[model samples]
Target: MTVFLIWSCSGKNASEISNETLLIVKKIEKINVLMGSAVGSSGHKPNQYENFEELKKNASKQELITLTNHSNGVVRCYSFWALALSENIDLFSIIKDHINDDTQVKTQFGCSGSTEKVGDFFINLVNPKDEDSDITKLTPDEFNKLDSLLIHKENNLYARYDAIANAVPTAYLYSKVREMVVKHNNQNALITLSKYKNPHDIELILKNRDPDEDGESGYFYTYKAIQNFPDPIFLPFLEKKLNETLDNDRYDGEWLQLYMAIASYKNQKSLELLTIPFTKVKHQDIKKYHIKFVYEAIIVNKSKLYDDLLWKIWQDENIITQEGFEYLLQLNKTKTLELSKKELNSNYQIKNTNTIPKINQSMFSQNLEENMLNFVLLNDKVFAYNVINDKIINTNVNDFEMYCSKILELKDPSFTEILFKRLKNEDNPHVYLQIVETLISFKDESINKRILETRKKNKNMNQDWGSEALDEILKKNKIK
Candidate 1:
């Protein structure tokens, strides 16, 4: 047991190190080696939860704070988690200094593992709603200083806003932040100022909008602020900027936000402007997605004009098949059934697997038989099952997993027994898991027995992520 001590007592008369700090240092070392940042049991590293539980039980606040600055990024992250769990700790004071700490830490949630910065990890840990949220525990001084601390980095803007943007009605804080915004032209500060909803700040926000920053950094907060404090006065500016983004053929997350802000106005003309991209956008990928957003906006507004436009686009096959089918089903049953059969029969060879097939029933009725009997008559059990089986056998298709997921959504009982038998044909863990899920959803009596039999034959399935997720899903559903 390496007794790593926090104190440096070299002199002969120096006091001995306390047992509390000594124990904390040892636990921190253990956590550094054995623990990864994870919440659930499915993907947790060995002893990850135990190490955190030990720290939560025995760690002194000062000792945890000392370890939070440790040279190791993972150590800092775990220590921060333990410290934030304390109910009485001033959450903002503890986190304010490390707001820009960019040390990356490996994290696991469920079956996925990802690498994220320590600062981002810390914010997410305390930012969720509940007793431990940072918002519920901030002090007056901490709240006042939040505006200043947030302006230091563009990356930290949204998080900093969440921590302190609760409309505390602090004139001094607002004025101080407004002056800082004017002097530095910080685009991030716009979100914080948006809570005030002052008309004077609108021009300031617009003046700071950088079209060059469209796809990169600052635009998310700008559009988010406009969405939060929406006004028709900002409409012309949003329209002009959105048109510029479209004309330049720039596509990104920010471009989505520009269109979303235009949609928020709920004006017929603004909604019609959104549909213009569907007709003219050159990229099919971009056009498909933007048209979906327009459809959603139209549904929200319940506008018949744009609804008819979607029907026209779907009939032309200008949009994704799923979106086209959704529009077609609303007004024309015969056409929708014809299109569904056409899509199911379309030859999906491995050579054409550039992208996963986009048809889904998640947006439509769960049972195809009830809604489209004519389509499901020949297509079900015989046609659709054969289509899936052919795609599954051709492992070179690369999108067999999507087909399996789509089958799960179809929820047809005819595919259940066949899927159980054909499960062995798929070697990909992701595809295998989807088949298992679809089988379980059927609630067939022999699922557990079949699963055990298959596992007995293929022992290596236990070693794969597919098997691990399979165990978790079965346990979660209370299936044997």
Candidate 2:
């Protein structure tokens, strides 16, 4: 049957297009050039893809369908998309034949882009609940039929997984989904199977998983599936994998998922497994990227079991000190403040490096800059004034502008003199302006006299905004 279809269509081969087909082919090629390297949303470049609309309006439905099998993957996708959106023909009928078409195309939706197989693209176009796309919506019956088409073992692997995931829970769908997962070693399909939370499915994933035979891809999806359906039954496997990664230093991009999956178990052993990287892996880059997952997992566990580990990380000055500090801040307030005071009194030197470890931003209510200030302030208003004074007077401290801005946010009068002292000696026009602005924010009468004295003393300073700011302060205070 396949040979017959190929032989019959060989006469009107894409290589030798008739005059009528030539125009549609040229328009399709233009859509490709205008879209550049990736197919985007219909509105991504409306003008560029207007060619598709032109073909939809003037070209016969057969013309568009014929182009679905064109030599170019882009042509095939756009042609199918045109048919799917037009609604003059049944999209499922057209898409059913192409469920196994594995030609890949680059697609962009908003800021994200990925290379997707053409068959998956067809499936996604009519996937229910995607109101944002231009494709026509399908009836529930049609959707079930579409998913049934994809659940066939012969279909594209991703499409099969996605269909099994979305299809109604039925004996056939479950059987097909399980068959693909167990028999074919389709680990990605395991993500869908694990969603059912079946013990048998979990055992299948565990028994079928041989990281040695499948390497890290199998482990990656297995970890993802386990993350979706976390169970204590898989704890030993996760622990062994965690140790293997730590001991071999072989974190081939599965560190975050693996760490969090183990962390999901949330037992003393899991906590110990998550902490292994801090002491075991000597690679700084890996630690920098993945330490937050470990920190987040431990903090969310809310167990003091890891307090010793957090304190150890805090005491040892390393790349992840901020993570340790913030973790302690969340889990142990008294200890966090004590550590903050110790660091403040020592005026700890923060090493300026290209990469700065941030407090896991989502976990905190405050943004990164405010959270950095809290690292010093400890959220204690009384202690913040003293720390601000100490940091401002040091002058050698890094990130001075950031510290100065915090003083403005605080709007306290005690910082006026400290800022004034810096202002009197500070020659950097930018820093001088920040100090003046911070002092002005204090709205204290004492700053008026101090400003007048400083302005008079520094009349020779070459600051563009220097005199203007001082004059504004004088005018605002009505001080001549």
Please give the CA lDDT of all the candidate structures. Answer: 0.60, 0.65
Q: How far out, in Å, is residue 340 in model 1?
A: 5.4
Report the lDDT tens digits of candidate 2 across residue range 449-477: 67767867775344567566656655765
> Could you estimate the TM-score for every candidate?
0.53, 0.58
Model 1: per-residue Cα lDDT at residue 400: 61
Worst 10 residues of 1 by lDDT: 8-17
Clashing pairs in 1: none
RMSD of each: 10.0, 9.3
Question: Model 1: number of clashes?
Answer: 0
